[model samples]
Target chain A: MASPIIITPAQVATSRDGEVVMLCLSGNWQITASPPRWEQPALDRPLRRIVLQAAAIGDWDSSLALYLSAARTWSGQQGVELVEQGVPAEVGRLAALLAPKPTPPAPQPQLADLVASVGQATHQLWQETKDLAQLLGECAYSLGRFIRGQAQFRWRDCFTEMQQCGALALPIVGLISFLVGVIMAYQAAVQLRQFGADIYVADLVGLSVVREMGPMMAAIVLAGRTGAAFAATLGNMQANEEIDALETLGVSPIDFLVMPRIMALFLMMPLLALYADFLGIMGGLVVTASILDIPSSLYWIETKSIIDLSDLSTGLIKAATFGLIIGLCACLRGLQAERSAVGAGRAATAAVVTSTLLIIVSDAVFAVIFNILGW
Target chain B: MNTASGKSKFAIEVEGVECRYGERVVLTNVSFAVKPSEIFFIIGGNGCGKSTLLRHLIGLKQPVQGQVKYFGRDFTHADRAGRQELLRTFGVLYQNGALWSSMTLAENVALPLELYTQLDRRERARIVSLKLAQVGLAGLEDYYPVELSGGMKRRAGLARALALDPAIVFFDEPSAGLDPITSLKLDELIRQIRDTLGTTIVIVSHELPSIFDIADRVVMIDSGARGVIAEGEPNQLREASPDQRVREFLNRRVAAVQQQQGILHP
Candidate 1:
């Protein structure tokens, strides 16, 4: 018998449904198209070997489009054939638009995309700055309108806020100031007992309450209680978009919202400062009476002699400035709020903290200025 | 602009109104007027200057150029007192409904009356209950707006708007992000408010369904259109406009598009 004829896989030209598919020596090449009409008939003879050559003469757009159309469509369904590991440069551009580019031919991060991202970040920063600027400008303009418009309303709100900020807040203020006065008198009594100057405790309590304890306690109380409340209220308003609602209501958030708070705090702060002084003095009276055994008559006599109106007025001025800074910062931050509720909280906390900082810094500056100017 | 003084008596007027945020131009020379007691709806795509334009009418945002007027008083030019006096005639129901979280619904409704009106506390409470009843929320007076549904919050806002018995009420995107049934209820409430209150209502929305169901006149403000391309009753708008955007917007929204589509003829 004649030796059986062997037709190797390479020699075979597979026709899919009778459309001629040229196989290459590499075993990877195959003609891809939409399942073609399959007009090409059977091969002339059994193939012996395969050779590869480019049949097309022109640009590969039509070929790429054909393959991609098939690939896109087949990929849309269940894919049948092996796709190339990476698209040809021609196909890559087309694929970029139609789908996310596949991995392996990783896209180099372009200078343009990086530049675009940087530009976006810069634009965002610039927008934030512009927003902050506009917010501040609006606050000032609104305050000016309020100052001009809110004559009676400001006083009313100030009185009401004073009750809220000062009278209602008095317990905490009084308690803390009282304790501080006792501590001062006790500390003085300890040191002075050895020096045979025990009665000087009355002078210590009297002087401290008149000067530092009054203003310092008042500032501390407002910072903790009133300042925080201001921040929280403003912050909540900011969060709730109530400020935006005010704007839409044609209510100048600054004028209608901020001005009342600012003016309220302004008027209230001095009254609060005075109340704090009275309570502080009362605290000192208790300490002087109990520890120093100095009578109220003597304590008041000494306090009146040393504590002039300027000392009181200086503290009052400082409290007013402190109130203004706290209310202004809180309201400004409130209006600067974004959508989230946390922003309002941050704004409120910031108001309290910022006011406390201002209270210190401004107090020192005012002290120097008043000393220099003889106010 | 001309009709603001003439026989037409524009209830609301915007003339050459320009608004911007930093460098980005939000609106450019948008000018239009709503007639007295008219149900005017301003419709546009997102970020297409709908809410911004609505804000200008109430003096929330001061326009960069020209003016927004109500009853011939320039809203932007007016001082706070002037604005407040002007504001007395209109109520704004903001996008969030702007109910105070700290206050209950009764307190929220009673606030404007407390601040602006001479109504006694008991009287204000009665009025608040009455307004809440009018919005189908009579029993929910004690609950906060926070506890209410989106639809309920809107209704509560409407009640608050009616607190001072204003002549006009402005709604900002009333149906946005709401379920269909809730949106439909709101649409009915809005129409009822107009028909019963006899109040001019201006709603800024792109929600096509609610806009057509209630708008006595729809003001279509596409960016490409010079300003407002179509203005008339909801049905008349579809027939009057040759613009494709207007037709697509109107025809689909309205039920009788069969005639417009020539479906009936064929």
Candidate 2:
């Protein structure tokens, strides 16, 4: 029969040897029974050593090791030595193994480390730029080959990409364009009415929507939607070594993989931009007629008088450039992706960021040039 | 030479390493070392973290504790120059034979040469052919990975891994998805590559036959122990291990075959 665990301070007595303090423990040393608390030995006492009287320890488990470990720690802090011989050999070994090592302090970032990281990042950026330029050159060469009927890509692929990039993008594009136009007209009406100039609201809405907002909004939507899709598809294929297979087959990946998608987006963006212009104008017309108390016929007349062929052509041109940017960035990032699952996701994110940035920068440059030419 | 003491001249040393995926600890307290030109095999049951250990050694992962070293230099803590030197010396063949799908076999072989070496186009092409020929893929240079059989894809992947004449190569489950005959051929090819190039090869596989045939030394991990339970020559472990768990694992196939025979006869 197993004895019940019992721990009492009275049972802990000084040994016949004056230097030792002994703890007498009986029965099962399990946490299920309340284990005895071992007090920290007094530093001022003549206690030079602490020992466990484990002769009565029956059916003990890890709780015994924990209690011994606590006693050892307390003894060490009080300049008292813990004699391991008194404890069961198994308990001693277990306590030693389970002891935690002191953790080292975390390293602080140094100025030198910061400078080195900056240097590394700059070099990486320069390398990426060179790679992107090389990819663009290769893509251009493939396009030339395509024009001369030398490229091997199927016409069916080009048409499929076109349908996916353009037709499939319509609903979201239409909804965004409508909301943008409505917001623009609502904001413009509040300002125009301040001077009783509400009649000029159509001119502001028509010119801004046709020349800038329509194409820019449409390009942003596509950058997030179509550009990310292209990156994800090609990046997944790259991870699976599908891209490597194309190279090994003596096929130019740009011609076989990228050319079709680029051609589709390049051909479709201007048409999509024109459609967005119509939707945005209709949205503005709804706000103008209902909120501004303007007649629908007069609103159309005002819009027609303010918008011209130059404004429409400029927006279409911008749309084409944005399409080229999105296609190039997406394909380049996808091709450069590492061979892993997370790598494909990272490539898609990079494609969206690069396409969005390039679109905004190119748009600014175009605005400056168009202003100079008075387009 | 004891690797834990940091006194051995080892090609790679993995000491007291632990691997975890999120909340689940996969492996713990694992330690081993490989010498130069040794064919080291890691064998384990399903989900025992054999591939995870390989990834940690290849620098694709950081161990939750402990460290991996290449010739006394810590892999994870190494500087960029040290890492580049390590990469240039190492080649990896992933399980699925990750050849770029868009490239021809010849072009795939030419890529690392183009990136890391200054060899001209003709020289690069010649080397590509030589490596392909080494893998018995001499004339199929224009074929894509998608067009190849499972064994052929692994062979092509091996060819690509050897492109830069790496000092060490790692293969993950090279016999997976291959028939017995094809797997035997692959084992022979792996031995040939090692003998000819004198490259240290680290293979993670559960194929007992291949392990016995190709491994200079084998380490068997236990999911229950959460660490390696046996380490020795395959024949030595099969014949002399005192642990019943090790004996059971080594004789598992024989026991299965006997049971099948018993069922058939009865």
lDDT of 2 by residue, A240-314 (tens): 856654443335679877988888888889988888888898888999899989998998999999999999999
TM-score of each: 0.66, 0.56
* Model 2, native contacts kept: 0.16
Please give, for residues B1-266, the per-residue lDDT of candidate 2 as tens digits: 11122344897888899988667888998999888788999988888889888877776667889888876778767785567566666777878788876569998788778756899999999999999999889998999888999889999988888888876788999999899999999899989988987888899998988988999998999888889999988889988988666776776644455554322241
DockQ of all candidates, in order? Answer: 0.30, 0.09
Model 2 lDDT on a 0 to 1 scale: 0.82
After superposition, which runs of candidate 1 have C-alpha atoms over 4 Å from their true positions?
A1-160, A171-205, A238-241, A244-313, A369-375, B1-7, B72-82, B102-104, B111-126, B139-143, B223-266
Off by more than 4 A, model 2: A1-42, A52-81, A85-108, A111-124, A152-157, B1-94, B97-172, B176-208, B211-266
Structure candidate 1, residue pairs in collision: A231-A348, A235-A344, A247-B60
